[model samples]
Target chain A: MFFYLIDVFGTMAFAISGVLTAINKKMDPFGVFVIAFVTAVGGGTLRDVLIGRSPVGWMRDLNYVYVIIAGFFLAVIFRKKLDKLRTSLFFFDTIGLGVFTLIGLEKGLEINLHPVICVALGTMTACFGGVTRDILCNEIPVIFRKEIYATICILGGCVFFLLKALHVPDGLLYILTSGVIIATRLMAVVFKWSLPPLSRD
Target chain B: MFFYLIDVFGTMAFAISGVLTAINKKMDPFGVFVIAFVTAVGGGTLRDVLIGRSPVGWMRDLNYVYVIIAGFFLAVIFRKKLDKLRTSLFFFDTIGLGVFTLIGLEKGLEINLHPVICVALGTMTACFGGVTRDILCNEIPVIFRKEIYATICILGGCVFFLLKALHVPDGLLYILTSGVIIATRLMAVVFKWSLPPLSRD
Candidate 1:
């Protein structure tokens, strides 16, 4: 039940990001909704496929469609409001990264996947949607070059696994892992930090 | 032996499409090769997951890496010559699409997927690279527009299954399907034909 809230909120955040990218591109209404839907679910779709989940999540939950459509209009109607706080979008986006990574890690753990694969899965769930949106918007994925995006997800997953190894209580571990991610991401942005680019030859 | 040529040429074709998109974006050499590799192999990777193949292609074969690097430099060197052509890229692109659809169709058949899924895979394999590149370049995919893109792949897939149904010789079927796709795409370009938008309502 707790994780379900995280799932829905993560979806909403991803959907908003997609809608904003569409707006930036001046895509029409239909185009906006399509990108929104794909962005919200694309990462999870890839995750489901990797773990052999048949038919995928949106196929089972019609509400996912409605949520994305609603998010699109919400963005369109609230364009001025959003534009006013364009800076906070980064914070909201980081919160999404935290929630998504935890949800993904829990899912992988449920399936009894190896720890490494679970870490990869959590990272993908948190990052792939933005990557998809960036591609659709013809922008380089910010995660690949921005303030330690995938790195934070990896660290969150590692925290989760460490808590599990210590036999920490599930509820407490959940809070700890997600808190670490959100805090780490926010601090990184506040500090203007990122992994250095690969050295030139 | 013949399939090998088709595979290599298809990779080359997809790589060129990626390079073109990257060049258009003014990406660095590493960035260009990254886009080229993603554009060239993303569809196949998606297909592999759907069909339960592990590790993906590029993770399995370093040859794909070599191809994208080679294609990137080749594009950088030949951009001037390429710019001189009125439609040479389009011509080769059509050929690439045709051959790619055939290979995708053959792979789907090997895995015994449903005919419908097979054709979908064929269209995907032939069109998805450009779609990814376009998305990364922050534009609507050309194929999603009314272009003779996905349509050509569909037409070619139909030719493939039709030839098999008629007990056509294997080599002849390959030639026939590819020829149909190339001819249809070129003809559409010549005629400036397109599918109607879905939202006339």
Candidate 2:
């Protein structure tokens, strides 16, 4: 039940991110909705597809679609106030990332996939929506270019498994894993941590 | 048997296009292979996922991977000669687009989706690999911005259903629909037909 709330919040945060990007790009309403929906669900969809899960997670549940629509309107109505809410938005986005990573990792474990592939799937789930959103908006994906985004998800996945090996209980595992992801992302931002770009030379 | 041959050829053509793009971007060999592989199978994989088909098309068959690898080496080894082969590549690419559109539409029909959604899926299958490649390379997707690429796929899908409703034979339907897509695309290129860009003003 707690995780469900986190999932809804994450979806809304990602949807808002997508809507802001579409608005900034001057996209039509249809394009805005499409981008917003994809941003909230694209990563999970990709993970489900890779793991051979059918109909994807979003298609099976209408709530995601509803949340995305709500998110779009919320962002549009509060566009003027968004700049001031940057910090709050970032916090929500980080929480979303953490929740999404746990969801993805758990899904992978359900299918008995390798730990490494599960970690990769978790990272993909937390990151690919933004990648899809940026692609649709015709910009370089911020995660791919500069950010400690996907890396945090990967690290959190590792932590989840490490704790599992140490016989952590289910509820505590979820909280600890999410806490690790959120804290790591926050520290990365505060420290201006980033991955090095591939050298062109 | 004939459709299988066409699918293989199309995969090769798309892979070549991906390799060329990666080379232009100065990506390393691994990156080039990654881009090429995604370009070859990304669209169909997406379609399969949306329809709840598990393991995707490429994962079930190893031939696609082998073909993509071959395409990568071919493009790399004959880099300088590629300019002279532009016309041939264009022909192959057009054929690939038609075959991929048919494949996607058929897959959708198998799952009993609406014809309109099937058409959209067909367009996604025909164009999205290129879109994914461009996004990974940090460029605007050519299909979304320019030319009549996806338009041709949609038109061909419409033609497919129209002919099917008129009781066209299966073999003849494939030929006629593919011919329509190929001819329309060729004509668009010859006449420089393109969608109007959104005005900045």
* Collision pairs in model 2: A55-B52
On residues B65-108, what C-alpha lDDT tens digit does candidate 2 reach at each position? 89999999999999889989989988999999999999888887
DockQ of each: 0.12, 0.16
Q: Which residue pairs in candidate 1 collide?
A: A135-B135, A135-B136, A137-B138, A138-B136, A138-B137, A138-B138
Candidate number with greatest lDDT: 2
Worst 10 residues of 1 chain B by lDDT: B54-63
lDDT of 1 by residue, B1-201 (tens): 776666676687678777767666655554565578768887777777767775455545566667766776777678667666427666666777888788779879999998888999888888888887777766778888868689888988988898899999999999999999989988898899898888967
Q: What is the clash count for each candidate, in the order shown?
A: 6, 1
Chain B TM, every candidate:
0.90, 0.98
- Which candidate number would show the highest TM-score if scored against the true structure? 2
Off by over 4 Å in 1: A199-201, B1-44, B50-201
Q: True-contact fraction for model 1? A: 0.17
Interface CA RMSD of each prediction in angstroms: 6.9, 4.9
